[model samples]
Target: MAQLTSIHRFPVKSCRGESVGSAVVEPWGLAGDRRWMVVDDAGAGITAREVNRLVLVHPEITDGGLRITAPDLPALEVPTPDPARQVPVAIWSSTLTAAAAGAEADAWISKALGVAARLVHLDDPTRRPTSPAFSEPGDLVSFADGYPVLLTTEESLAALNDVVLASADTGRDPLPMTRFRPNVVVSGVEPWAEDDWRRIRIGDAVFRAVKGCARCVLTTIDPDSAVREKEPIRSLAKIRRWDGATWFGINLVPDTYDVTIRVGDEFEVLEAVAPGSGPLRPAP
Candidate 1:
């Protein structure tokens, strides 16, 4: 049986995440995951894609709200913003109202990134639904690109590393799972076994696999030095490239909320979606 080996969540979007022993599965996503984001003057989301240094800002979820710590910068604690102070923000094709985290947070984050930025929180995740093409009715997501959660398997990484070592032009250093920023890391699965999974259950919570997550340049950035390289993407381009984008982890939407998923939780493959078939029903 496959077991969850690790769990992580980003309290703020596009920044480094915090590893957690267990996390509550919410309707939108892991509770407190990507509920906050940094926005530009136009209120459009800004990510590490343009400001790689943002990864250096580590955020920890606190009882008061969020505390962010970064190199050469003082830690800043921010409380949740008032719902009435919402500002219009756009994330990809989806646009919604988000509450601004106030001028202090804006100043702190702006200085950290060396760009004009404002911190905003999704006061209501339900305001946006997962793409109808890939999700069921009422399936909601947080500030995550498209899905509530992302799942990756250890075997796939090993397999990719093997390919990387074999390729002459690609750097052979093994890539850490952090490159993908998966919420749940599983073990005991064959390489890329999740590509066909339609539904799975971990602990008491069930989840539906919606689609494969497409890779981006962010994966090429070294989380430690913030240096961008060409290995994983260069190697993945040769293996998983299609439609102009490389593919990696699978995106998942929870079937049940309020359940806590812990590391070491055994997972069951409830259903597998056949090629050309629609969503598969979970086994009874």
Candidate 2:
């Protein structure tokens, strides 16, 4: 009887996310989720480590198109266009051809961050390859790390905060869920119940919880403005590290089909689809 209270999609990875009233669940990941990324001249990915200012960039899908605004510059606009010039880029293990959003986007990012960067679209069918672990013969993905959606529970965060508060020396501010950047934030569940949920139904959409999401420096960086803090990372390091990798959130495998998910949708836990067999530790 747990309900899905919120849904979010980060069109661009590691940047601010858009709180959607509804969205489509596709095999490649949430439709339009992580469909764009900021990269340097070599086509390597960029993150808060390379440029802290990247955290300052906030993006929202506007009626005109995708609008990117920062603290210092005017909003940069990217119109939804036919896939532009194809460019080569790598997202994790997948080497794919992404649509190049071109020089205007490049100039804006470069000027704002004082670094060479450009915007690339994750729409190329030929270059993008689906994860071998989950692809059906010839599936393709835009820019998701692996799965279609990343799920987290508010109860889990509350539990982690409780741990932080119980310890006297941490001196950390409890963070908003934004720091974790989850696609689905569920409430009313036992802390970490998602770790073992095999099939989860939210609204009309159903997702198969697959694996625990490995955490990275991105978790430590504030998504809104790319500010880095020690308490969260340090605290997570103390409690959530597993198998040499720090992790947060659960990665999900959607039943390869089009599922409509909207805001304010209700979720029903039909069964205990999967159960966590791994050790519970704080992400390091």
Candidate 3:
């Protein structure tokens, strides 16, 4: 058994996340998780992976909507756009409908990052379905990359940091879990134990592990400093490279809704099976 050490909620995709003691589980994801997103003038999604300063944009959840704040910038309150007024937006290759937060928001965020960007809200959480390859029919998600929740274990991160510290090629500094931007962080588990989780229960919520999280260059960006560096990825390529990608953590879909998961909640694996591992190892 492992303990859920933290619950993070990212109101806006790829921006800074806030750690909460407890979060309400919605069918799409935790309440308010990634329901908002920044997009280019073409209505294509923009993330910190491309604009590092986006990590500095802090969206504080408000009664009516969001209060977006950033360093050396005046905060802006963005109200929820009318659900009836949705516009076409592109996420990856998918064209989805979302509510535009109006010109004020677009200008604020654009000026904040010194780029032309617009902010949009997921008017309906059920608008997007999870990838059919990994999810059952009727499963849905918000503006998140794919799955509803991303889970990472402290033990696995510790193991990766150990290898990173031993390497002379990397910065030799241990990375924080924030770099990965996981929604649920678990502790007190063996390194990479999540690899075998088929189904698990955390607190009152049950989840099915659908896919392993393939890391990208976004993990190399520091959320606090907005500085990009070669790290975890540098070490991950040595120990976690497989299928032509560096892997870490896992993606989960909830089996139930309205389940509140709190920090310090006890989690247990109900089912397990060895996952595919062609070249993955502790270290090369």
Candidate 4:
């Protein structure tokens, strides 16, 4: 059995996350995770994929609302928009309405990203259903990439780093799991063992593995320095590459609500596919 070693919560999308001891799992995701996001002047989503410096934006969930701080900027406290003034926002291919964070947050985030941007919150997360291909009818997600949560194991990271360190041209020392930005980090598993997991339980909540998370160049960016490198992505291509993309963590959708998943919780596989060939499978 694997153990849940860490639980990370990203209050605002594309920003630095906070490691928590425990959190309530809502149907869409962890209660304060990805509920807010930065958008362009046109209401399209903006992420660190384009502006690596966005990772330097640190957002923390406070009892009343959100407090955001950046490298040289003073901390700003933002209250949840009262009465939820709705505005149209586009995330990926999905179009939805969210609460606008007003001109204050917009101006602050705009300066942080060095672009014209606005901040918005998913006051009603139920408005966005997850992808039809990988999710059930009622499966919902926040401003996350797709699924409700992303799961990764330490064993897999260690194995991937081993191969990364062995590469002659690899410039990185070793990649940390933070680069993957997983919501739950599990320990005590063989490398790539999660490839066969179809369903899993972490404490009181059950989750169905929607799909293996296809990593992109965004993973190559350092969260601290915002520097972009090619080794992790380049090395990931060598071993985890298949299906025309490099694979990393597993995206999961929770089957239970109101369950608080804590650090050091028991993680068990409830179902699995037959061990076989796939992009997420272990290299032979």
Candidate 5:
């Protein structure tokens, strides 16, 4: 039996994630995760990739709503209202019509990052629908990377750590799982066993394994400080490249949109499908 050891939600894209005891699972993903994003004045999305400073911005839920703090500006609070203003935006390849969350959020971000920007909330009803491959009649999502939860087994990280340690120069410390930023980390499993999980029941919530998550530079970004390192990325590239991209974690489809997940939730692994049958590894 597999057990859940941690739960995390990134309130904003590419920023620091909050370690939570429990979280509500919506169709798109965890209720408060990645619902709002900072975008330029022309409605173009911004992320830690382009603005490394975004890594310094941290968001926390407050009694009023969401409070955000960055190194360069005072904290700004925005109420969790279905904002009156709406706009069209793009997240990855999907085009979405979302709500412009708060002008105050924009002001704070603009001042801190020294760029003209706005906060856009993902509110498209059509986009809320889940992928046809995993959707039943009523599947709904809030906002996630592409699924409900991302699962990565500790064994996989251990396996990768071995590669990281072997490849690193003498002084660097071994990488932590935070580098991958999975929502769920399962223990007592074989290396990469999560790749074959058909269904996993954590407490009352059941998550279906949908696909393999393709990794990116975000995996190399240090979550705590937003600093980038080269050893692990180079190591992972040598060992785990898939389809020309290095990848980790398994994308998930929850049994229901209303399920809530918490840390210490016991997981019952129902079945293991074929392992090592997904995307190709990147050439080193």
Candidate 6:
């Protein structure tokens, strides 16, 4: 039986995430996950992809809002922005009105990143919908790249690491699961078994495997050191490359909003599409 072994939530996009024993599955994703984000002067979403140091920023969800802390900077507690303070923000291709966290929060983030940046909050995740190509109608997501939940398997990580060690010597260390930043990690599954899963049930919640999470330069950024290196991305390209992208974990969209998932919860595959089918495609 496959059991969920880890639960993680990034209260702020591209920032360090928190591990929890349990998480509430809302319509968009885990509660408080990616509810806030760092944006450039133009109000476009920023991530570790460009500024690796962003991963060093840690956000703790507080009573009213968030308390963000980073090296060489004092912790800053920010209250939820008033809805009337909404600003137009763009995350990828989706543009939506997000509540601005105000100048105090923006200044703190700007100093921490050593770049002009602003902090914005997603007052309602439902304002942005998932790509219709991979999702059902009316499917919504938080400030995530696309899907709601990302799931990875321990066996797959081990297999990828073995490949990395066997491949060209880059002097890079074996990668940790954190490199993938998954919302849920499943143990006791065959390596890459999730590639074939179309529908799965965890506890009382059901989810549709929407798409394969394509690898990117962000995967090369070390979470702790804020340093970039040729890595898992290099190795993944050798084996998992398809359709011009390297694939790793799978993206999931839940069937409903009101489910609570725990680390020890058992998961069952209710349906599976054919192998070699695009990991993100709906089962025919």
Q: By lDDT, is 1 or 6 better?
A: 6
lDDT of 1 by residue, 1-284 (tens): 78999999999898999999999999999998999999999999999989998888899999988999888889999998999998999999899999999999999999999999999999899998988878889999999998899999999999888887887574456889998889999999888778778889999999998888889999988887778988689889988777677888888999999999999999888988654342222222
Tell me the lDDT of model 1 at 241: 78
TM-score of each candidate structure, all chains considered together: 0.94, 0.88, 0.95, 0.96, 0.89, 0.97
Clashing pairs in 6: 211-280
Clashing residue pair totals per candidate (backbone < 3 A): 0, 14, 0, 0, 10, 1
Q: Best to worst by TM-score, what's the order? A: 6, 4, 3, 1, 5, 2
**Which residue segments of model 6 deviate by more than 4 Å?**
168-172
- Whole-model Cα lDDT per candidate? 0.88, 0.73, 0.89, 0.89, 0.73, 0.91
Candidate 6 worst ten-residue window by lDDT: 165-174
Q: What count of clashes does model 6 give?
A: 1
Q: Compose the digit string of candidate 3's lDDT tens values, residues 1-284.
A: 57999999999998899999999988888998999999999899999989999999999899999999999889999999988878889887568899999999999999988999999999888889998878889999898898899999999999999998898563556889999999999998889888878788899999888888999999999889999988879999999988889999998899979989999999898877765432122111
Predicted structure 5, TM vs. truth: 0.89
In the range 1-284, model 4's lDDT, one tens digit per residue, is 67999999999999999999999999999989999989997889999999888899999998878999998899999999864598899999889999988999889998988999999989999999999887789999999999899999999999889988888473656888889999999999889988888889999999988789999988999998999988688888998888888999898999989989999899999987777745242233
Of the candidates numbered 4 and 5, which has the greater TM-score value? 4
Which numbered prediction scores highest in lDDT against the true structure? 6
Worst 10 residues of 4 by lDDT: 275-284
- Compute the lDDT for candidate 4: 0.89
Report the number of the highest-TM-score candidate. Answer: 6
Q: Please report how far candidate 6 places residue 55 from its true position, in Å.
A: 0.4
Show where candidate 2 strays beyond 4 Å.
Answer: 125-127, 134-140, 168-172, 270-276, 279-284
Q: Whole-model lDDT, candidate 6? A: 0.91
Residue 109 in candidate 6, Cα distance off native in Å: 0.3
Residue pairs with colliding backbones in model 3 are none
User: Model 2 over residues 1-284: C-alpha lDDT tens digits?
Assistant: 57777888887776778887778888767777888888888787776666878767787876645899888799989875457677777766766677788788889878877899988877643356556664345555557677668888888898878766767474657778887878888888898776656667888877666567877777777765566765456666787876887767887656645878876678766545335555232111
